[model samples]
Target: MSDSSTLPPARLRPEAELARDALSAPVLARAARLARWADAGTRVDAGGGLVEEQLPAAAEQLGLSGDDAAAHASEAWRIAVDTGLVEITDEETGTVAAGEDLALLTGGSPQDVLGVWLTALEAVLADASVPDLDDLVDAMAEGGEVDLSSLDWDPEAESDFLDGVLGNLYLLTVGEEGPGEAPVPLPALAASVIVPSDMGEPSNEVLEQVSDAMMRLDDQFRLLEPVGLVEYQPVDEALMADADEEPAAPVDEADVTRYGMVRLTPLGLYGLRARLLDAGFEAPAVGDLSDKGADALLDGTAPFPPAAAHAETELWLAGRSPLDAARELLAAARGTDPGAPLRRLRCQQALSLVGAEAEPALREVLDDAELGGLARVWLTEHGARDVPPPPQEMVFWLTIDTVAAQLAAEGNSEELRALVEGLARQHSGFFDTVWRVEHPATPEVLEAMGRLHPDKKVAKEARKAAFKARSQQGG
Candidate 1:
């Protein structure tokens, strides 16, 4: 045998190395076969036993004794579960049952089984601190074939070998660390790893085709579990004659053959994406509400520029009706000119027609700096009516500001007076700021401010402003 230790380092690309490592291991070869079988929709059934009878036969075929076969099978099963290739369930009787749809062993074609094993093996090898290709090949080739009938059944040895293999596989594929210490799995890894170069977006049609293919593969493999029944026969002829009675009702073949299917989960979606990416399609970025005019349209209080208004209206119509023509018009307007005021006005009018549903999207844009003072004021006036009460942190200031502004804007002098008095009784500083800086300081405004100014300094300032406004107005 060649001295693996003395061999020169093999110069190969990462993909080539992965391909080589995958082909070197029997366990991985078997796994790859299983994956292909699963992809093809093959069904694999396990007989009712910890070690199925057919499993031994398959082991014998692979040149392993019963113990070795059992060991390898157990290891494979454990690895598969750890890698999420198979799901396990607990029976009421405390037995752990493997799902029927798991395409491991059970007469799946060697190629299919090998493909799954390789896929798993490749994943493990990606992170494994393997010494070299020679080391990996040597480790895989260490065990020799055995005959089951000649070997003694040592459950512990089998279990130990399985544990060792799994440990090595884990270390190789992930790292030499416990679960929490390892890096979190990325959802996009599969896309980067498995998909080939030709497949495109995972359209519903493509998914359906893949699902159909898997279903057909399952039917072809016949890897489904079988139901066993006990037959009680009389030992003696006389007893048999005496016990003779109607045969038990015929077993329903359909009931015995039925098995549940495994549907795609989120992880499976990641895996599917990976497979598609491997197969060669670029995943598209899903567009969000911000991408549409919904963000600008939702704030009902804001005075939109004609372009923004048109965009909002188009978005609303898109949500409301089949306004394809209107949408086209909006899109055209946006692309038409840099400073088209009339276009923007037209857009706003269209959005105004859309109404309330646009509120949330509009509110989201209130913090946008680009919208300018006009938009902010429009949003304040139009959006405030529908704006949910300000959150707790802002409530105190918001209420004071709202009340003060309304008092200044109110047409009725008596109501204005009452509002000003209320402000003076409450937060006088806030009232002072509103009266002095925020209001227009007309005689009515000054009188309202004067009534609320509680501090001597604030009261004197209010009085001076009130007198000047009165003198100017000739009141």
Candidate 2:
């Protein structure tokens, strides 16, 4: 219930924990300075996006070249926006200004500052390295998850070309670590070599270009260390004896360069996870469930979106027997929590995926009114012999409950809205009949749709439908 700053150390310290691995002091200092300038009402040049022209002014102020100023502004602006030092209200209209969080950050601890900076690091990478990263991610994902390892090289040895640079260390954190293999060191030169518009194996010249890009990026990465997005060290303490000086490198390329194995740190892994979610990627959080049984899996996913929970359930059930999986799911759904209704809904979905094998276990609950509706739906959908239809009210209520469960999960409201609106249109007197249906969540779902539907008319209609449904129940 508390903010990250107020919470205890053992209770989910994502920012502090992640910042430990990266070099973040410089980034935090720059972000703080940018925030102070914003408090004085500074702008990133109101005319023509400012990097080419106004960067010189900023450079003179910061004692750097125009190009360095541009790079600093590019990174610092993104950090500011992400950490609430700067807020971009409208990208199209170019409306941006300092934010309320700037003052809070000014007084923040080093961990807090680096944590906020880490939060914005993903967006900074997207701006600098992968402009169309969003589209590429959409193309890369399959069955609600992204798997770079699954991709085949196209007659060129360009395996994980995008993944190497843009794929990031997030995958490394969540993915299966190879058995007995060392931390496969990815050097600085190997870090670059992007294809620009194409994906192919690199030539010697391409390696040089990629190496150059990595060198430039290494500068930014050094500033990133305290935030923990990436890690590099001197491999000796005396090398960086002066705390204010930039850390010295190994100075030899054959074994290690100034920047050591510059891969995504564990902290960077989670930072990327958050960033991916913000951009609408269904990044998986399937942590170490490889050894978990059906009971453990169901217990863990009780509150997950049905689609996400179903995917996890199937994975858990893959090595086990379907009937057994169904039994375990049904057992977990029998919890007495106030949230049991939605939990049962997700469990039923997983049971359905187990197919007709789950019917025998489901049928035992058919007479219990609370769970019988779900059982009836499963039996009817699975073509069980001699299964009689439930009352008209039960059918309608169950349909509404299914929609309610999806709404609870916050999955694809656009599709849900379209489906609900279509059903309302198909039945001309939708509200009249639906209001009379006896369902506990009918009013709640309708009210939610009223607020969530994009169209004013549809939203208003949903509100009216909810009022009528409430009145029918005399509420």
| Highest-scoring model, TM-score | 2
For every model shown, what is its TM-score relative to the native structure?
0.20, 0.41
Q: Per-residue lDDT tens digits of candidate 2, residues 245-312?
A: 54322336665643445555555565655555565555546433435865566556655544446556
Q: After superposition, how far is residue 203 of candidate 2 from its true place, in Å?
A: 37
Q: Global lDDT of each model?
A: 0.36, 0.57
Report the C-alpha displacement of residue 121, candidate 1, in angstroms.
7.1
Off by over 4 Å in 2: 1-299, 302-311, 318-320, 334-338, 380-383, 436-438, 452-461, 468-475
Any idea how many clashes model 2 has? 7
